[model samples]
Target: NQPGEVFYTEYTYRPWIQIDLQQFIVVTHVIKRDIRTPKVPPQDLYGMYVSKRQWDFVNRGARACFFGLTENEYNCRRPITGQYVTLTLEYEQDSYLDALMDLKVFGLPTGCGRSLGMTTGDIKDYQIETSSNYKDIHQSRAMQGIEGWCSSATDMNRWLMVDFIVPTEVQGVILHGWYQMKRMFIYSFVVEFGLQEHTLRLYGEDGLDPKIFTIDSIQDVHILQKFMFLQNILTRYIKIRVIDPSNDIACFKAEFIGCQVYGNKL
Candidate 1:
C-alpha cells in the first residue's frame, strides 16, 4: 500500500487497531516498525505504544511504553496471552495520524494463559480482608473483570510475599496497579528479594537474606509497570511493600519473572 493509503482513524473517535487471533493463544512478544519514510528512523516522530487485550476502554490489560518506542521494541514484560491482542496509540490524532510501517506478534497457541510467577505455592501469612483477596496478587488482570488485591489498612505497611519453594533465578518483576472499578493505583512501592532455608522461621535469623535492588520512588504509575534487575538474582522469597502512606489506599497485582535454577539452594 502507498504511504498515503495507510489507515488513519477518524479524529472524531479514538484511534486504535485490534487483531483477533480468533482463538486463545500465548502471546510471547510484539514488534512494531515505523512508517516507511526514511532509511534511518527519525527523532520526535516516535509515539507511545500500548499492547493490550480486549477493549481499550479499560486499562487493566495494558502494557505500555511510557515514551515512544525505544529502539523499536516493546516486549511483554510479563506474559500477555489472550484471544484478541490490541495495539493503541497514547496520543490522539492531531496533525497526523499515528502510522505503522509494520507490526508483528509472536506466540504459541497453547489456549491456556501463562504467568512467570509460581501460581500454586506457599505465600506468606497475612490478615485476610473480606473485600480483598491475597491470591489476586498473582493474577494477570487488574480490575478488568475481577477485583484485584487491596490492603485493608492504609499505613504504608502492606506487603505481599511469595515463596517459590525453591531458589529461583529472578530476572525482573512486573506490577499492575488496581486499574479496575474505582482505580485505586499504587503510586509508589518498593521490592525486596531474599532467600531463606526454612519457612517456619518467619524471618531469616542468620542475617543471610539481603536486599538486592531498591526502587524507592516511582511516581504516577497507573497500569502495568516492569522493573528488571541489573543482573539475575537467585532467591527463594520475594517481598513487595507499598511504603507511600499518603494515598489512603494501596492496591496492586504483580508477577515475578525468571526461572527455577535446578538443584540450587541458597
Candidate 2:
C-alpha cells in the first residue's frame, strides 16, 4: 500500500497510475478513495481499466467502470481476468493536474500458482539440504537472495533437496539461474521425490525411467523458469539433481508451488 497522494505534473498529459497484481487474477471490482485534504482537494478519476497484457492500459483493456463525475468506488459489470490494473484520466483540460489518494482491487488467484513458502521463510534453513557448496554459498541461499546456492565445482554427485516436513501436493517449481561476477545456470536436470530420501523415485511419465528436462539455451539464464509437473505428486521430500551444469557449477535459486495435503498419505 502506498502512503500519501500520487500527483501528476502539469505538463504530463493523460497521466495514469498502474498497479501490478503480480499474477493473473479474476478481478470483480475496484475501489478509488479520495480522502479530503486541506491543502489539496481530491482530483477526479475518469477511467478504470484492467488487462492481462502489460501494454494494454488504455481503451484496448476491459473497462471495469468509468466515472463521468467524481466517484468513491467503481464496480465492473462482469469479472475481468488480468494481471495489471490501470487508472487513466480522460478529460478535456490539457493542463489539468490530477491526484489519486488510494486505489484497491479485488480478485482471486487463477490457479495453484501460490508459493509453498520456499522464498517466504515458512520453510526453515535446516529444511533445505545440499550435497556440497562452493565456499560460503550454502543451500539456504536458494530460498530467497541475489547470491543463490552454488554447489562445489569438484562435486559430480550434486543435488539439492527440500524437506517439506509434511505431505505436500507439489504442483511446480520456479527455478532462477545464479548471476554475480559470472553467469551460471542448469542446462538440464532431473526431479525426484518420495516419502523417504533413501527410496526417492524419478519424476517421469513412467515411475521407472528418468525424465531429463533441458533448459534449452543460455537466453534462459538469470531468468525465473517455471517447470510444472505433468501431475501433482504427494510427497514430503523433493530433490533436484543437476544433469548438465553450466560452467561446471550447479548454481540456482528455487521456489516450490502447491498446498499442503490434509488427509492424504504417502
Candidate 3:
C-alpha cells in the first residue's frame, strides 16, 4: 500500500428464504476507519450511487413504495473517518404483490429483495420441484371492471408480467389467480399473468377448472403503453395488470411508475 492510497472492502452476506418467491432489502455502507487523521475539514463522498425511498401507504397484499436512487461519482473530501453514514438502493419502482405470487410455485430464493414478502414468519425463500401455473385471458380483466374512480384528473393503466424459471426437470403445469382486497376504494382489478413457453391448466378463483387458453406472451395481455421496469428474480418473472385508475389512490395519485432490480444474478 502507498501513501494517499485508498481501497474499498465489503462484508459478505449469505441469504436464505423460505417462501417460493423472496424479496429482501439490505442497507450497506463502509465502516469508519479505525485510525485517526489530521484536523482537516470533513471530506465528501463522491461517485457513489444510492436509492432514496419514502413510503406513503402500507397495506396487506400490496404496498405503495416510491424508489429513487441518489447517485454521485466523487471522492469524500471530509477529514473525518469514524462517523455514521447512510446510503440508498437502486430499486426504483412500485414493487407489487402479484410480482410476489408469480414465483410462489416453482421459483427458488435468490439475491436481495427476496425476503420482503407480506408475511415475516414465512421462509426466506423456497425452491419448488413442481411446475409453475397461471392463467391469463378475458376473465383477466379485473381492476378495469372495478367501479368508482379514486379521483379524477388522473387516468392510468398498467400491465405487469413475471417470468418463472423452473428446472428443465419439470414437466407440464397448472396456474391459478386468487385475489382479495380488504377495501375496494383504491384497488381496481384482479391482476393476472400468463405462462408462456410452458403449457398450463387454467383455474378460476372459485376453484373450478376454466377450460380455455388464457393469454399468449406478456404482450398478449393487451393493456396499453405498459412501461417495463428492470427487476431481479431468480429465473422467474412476475407481472401486474393495472387498469386505467383515477388519482387519489393513495392520499395522492397512487402512481405505479417504475421498478428496477439490483441487476443481481438469477
Candidate 4:
C-alpha cells in the first residue's frame, strides 16, 4: 500500500510507473489503482509490459492494454519472465500527469520459469490426485493450502499426480514440506511425465534414463526446494513418486512450474 500523494510524475508525454523487482520473475498479473484528484481524471487507457531488458517494453512493444477504468487488473495471457514491469498511461493531450494509489504485480520467482497456473488456481482439486492420503489431509491440499498433501503411513508406492489437461512445457517443480515439526521432508524422488499416464518417461540428467534426485535429510523442512529438468518436457501429466520419504510419509506442497505451449503474448 502507498499514500496517494507519494508517487506522482510531473506532466509529461508518457507518464509511467516502472517497478524493479531486482530479480527475474514470471509475471502473471498486474493491478493498478487510481488516486482520485480534484482536477486530474484517472487514466482512461494504459499499457502494461514486462521484460528482462530494461527498455524491451519500448523495443518489443507493450504486452497488454487496459481501458476505461479507474482501477483495473491486467492478467497476462502468457506468463512473462522479466526483472522490470512498467505501466504507461495514455492521454489524448500532449502531456499529462498521473498519480497512482497502488501498483501490484503477482508472479512466481522462477526466473525464466513460467507458471503452470498452480498458484492462480487454474489447476483445480480434481486435477490433482495422490496414491493415498493421510486421514483428512487430502491431495487437494498439495498446493496453495495450509495443510499439504500427505500419504497414509501404511501406503506403499506413494505418488502424487497432476494433469494439466493440455500439453504444457514443464521446466521444473517447486516443493515445500510440512513446516511445523521437521516433518514431511522428501529425501528422494523420481519425476515422470508424458502426454499419456501409461507411457510416462522418467525425467533424468540426460532426459532419457531413470534417475532419482536425493536431498539431504538434515535440510530445513520449511524451505522451498526446486528441481529443474535438464530439458523442458512437453507433457499433459506429471507424477512425483517418492523413493525415500521423510519418516516414511510422502508429504509436501508442490507447484509444477511451466507455461502453456501456445498462447498470445501478454
Candidate 5:
C-alpha cells in the first residue's frame, strides 16, 4: 500500500520540477508511476534538457495515459544527455493538477566526485582582511565545528570566484548560506561563468563579464540553493556576486560539482 501523493500548483504558469543528477549521465529510461482508483489520474508530459555546446530542450513524453486499478506507468526510453533533467507537467485545463506515486530514473554513473570546489584555485575578494582564515570559502570546516564561508560585514562589493585550474566541464553549483546567522543569509545573487583568465579579471571589475548564465530572483535563504546547467560547460572560472544580501551581509558555503572532461589545458 503506497501513500497517495498529489502534486498540484497554484495559479502559476509552466510550473515544473527540475532534478539535478549532479553530474552527466547516460539516461537509459525514466519511469513515472501513478496511483490507481484515485480521485484524478496523473496527466503530465515529460521532457529533457541536454547540453552540447549549448542547451537543447526536447519533448520526449511519447505516450502518457492512465488505466484504472493499476495506474499506468509512463516510461520514456529516450537516451538523453546532460547533467540536469527537468520533468515538466502539462495540463489541458487552466488549473494545474497532477499526481505522482513514484519516480525512478535509471542511468549509468559518470564517475564524478561530490564537490569540485575543494580543488579550486584562490578565492577572491571574499573578505578584505582574513582572520583565522575564516573567510576562506574553499574550506569545508568552520570554527567550533560549524561549517560555512564568512564574509566581511561591510564589504559592499563582495564576490566568490572559483578557478578550476583548467578548463573543466561543470555540471552545476550549490550555495549554502549561513543558517546559524539570521542576518547573514543571502536572498538574491548573480552568477557568472567564464572560460578565459582575462574574462575572470574583467568580470571582477564590474559590468564587464559577458553573462553566460544568470538568475536574479532566488529566495532560498539559509538553505542549499542549487543551479544545474542543462549542458556541460567547459570553463576555467566561475563567480558568484552578492546582490541583495537581504541582511546587509552575505555569508555562505559553496560547492562546485562536476568532473574533468579532458586533461589539464596547457
Candidate 6:
C-alpha cells in the first residue's frame, strides 16, 4: 500500500499515513587539539568522535512531500520516522554546473566543532556553481571610461591555490578559475581540507576548459560541470583549489586573515 495509491474503496484510514520526514541535517565543529601537550593523555587522545554518520532530519505533515522520499510528489505523502537514514553523500564541487551537494551523513569529531548543514535527498548527481554568469549586465551600467580588466598573478605559468574560508556551519563552497589560455598543455588543480573528523576535497586531471569548471572530488569522479569537478565532502574548509608550483610566485591578492597556533603548558 502506498500514499495516494488510488484507494479503490475504503480501508481503516487513508492509506496515506502522515509521518515526519527526516530532513538530513549536518552540524560541524573544528578543533585544534595537540595530544603532545604534556599530560594530555597518550598519542591516542583525539578531541571528539562523531560515532554517528547518518542523521535524521524530521519533516512533519499529514500530506506533505518528504526530503528523501521521491515519487510522493505534490498531493501525496509517505510514512517514515525515527528511522536512521543510510547515506552516500556526494560533494558537489563542480563550479560549472548548478548542483546541490548530497547526503554527507555523519562526522567523527575531534577537538572542536566548526560547522555543517542540513539538506534533503541523495544528491549523487548534483554540482555547485562557482563563477558568476553576469553576462547580461548592461554595458551602460559600466562606469564611464571603465575598461574590462582582470588582475592576474603567476598567470598561466604558475599554479594558484584557491582557498575558501567559509563561515562556521557552511557546508558548501564553489571554486572558480579561468583556463582561457588557448593551449593544450596539461595542468592540475588540487583541493583538499580536513578537520580531524570532517573532510572536504576537489581536484582535476587537466585544465583546458574554456567554459565553466567544476570538481566533485569530495565524493565521486563522474559527472563534471562544463569543466567542473565534483566533490561532496563534509568539512569546514569546503573549498580549496591550487596549482602553485615551487617555481611560481605572486598569486592574485586574495583577502584573508592568518592565525598562529602555539603549544602552551602553563
Best by TM-score: 2
Find the candidate with the highest lDDT and give its number: 2
Please report, in order, the local distance difference test score of every candidate based on alpha carbons: 0.52, 0.72, 0.24, 0.71, 0.51, 0.24
TM-score of model 1 (CA atoms): 0.44
The residue-by-residue lDDT of candidate 6 on 1-266, one tens digit each, is 33333222123221111111122222232122122233333222111112112222222211122222111111112322221332111122311111212223232223222112111111111222122212211111112112211213324433222222332322222222222332111223444444321444343334433222334434321111122123223333423343434333211111111111222411
* Candidate 2 lDDT over residue span 10-47, tens digit each: 65567667887856578888887655442434356567
Q: Local error of candidate 2 at 190, Å?
A: 2.1
Q: List CA RMSD, all candidates.
A: 10.9, 6.7, 19.1, 10.6, 7.8, 20.1
Give the Cα error of residue 18 in candidate 5, in Å: 9.1
Model 2 misplaced stretches (Cα beyond 4 Å):
1-103, 108-112, 135-143, 205-211, 216-221, 245-247, 264-266
Ranking by TM-score: 2, 4, 5, 1, 6, 3
Task: Flag the better candidate by lDDT, 1 or 5.
Answer: 1
Better lDDT candidate (1, 6): 1
State the displacement of the C-alpha of residue 240, model 5, in Å, after optimal TM-score superposition.
Answer: 2.5
lDDT of 4 at 173: 77
Q: Write the per-residue lDDT of candidate 5 for residues 198-266, one digit (tens) a residue.
A: 575322223554333333335544445556655556778777676763435556666676777676442
Clashes per prediction?
A: 0, 0, 52, 1, 1, 48
- After superposition, candidate 4 runs with Cα above 4 Å error: 1-112, 135-143, 180-182, 216-218, 245-247, 263-266
As a TM-score, model 6 comes out at: 0.22
Please give the lDDT score at residue 2 for candidate 6: 36
TM-score of each model, paired residue for residue = 0.44, 0.60, 0.20, 0.56, 0.52, 0.22
Q: What stretches of model 3 exceed 4 Å from their correct place?
A: 1-29, 32-110, 114-160, 167-190, 193-237, 245-266
Candidate 1 per-residue C-alpha lDDT over 1-266 given as tens digits, one digit per residue, 9 for 90 to 100? 45654565555433456666644456766766656454355343333233323453345345443235344555666565455666555444454335566667777774222244333233333311223343354342322435456665534467666666677776666666543556555655555656763332222223565333323235443445556555666777766666664746566666665655777344
lDDT of 3 at 133: 17
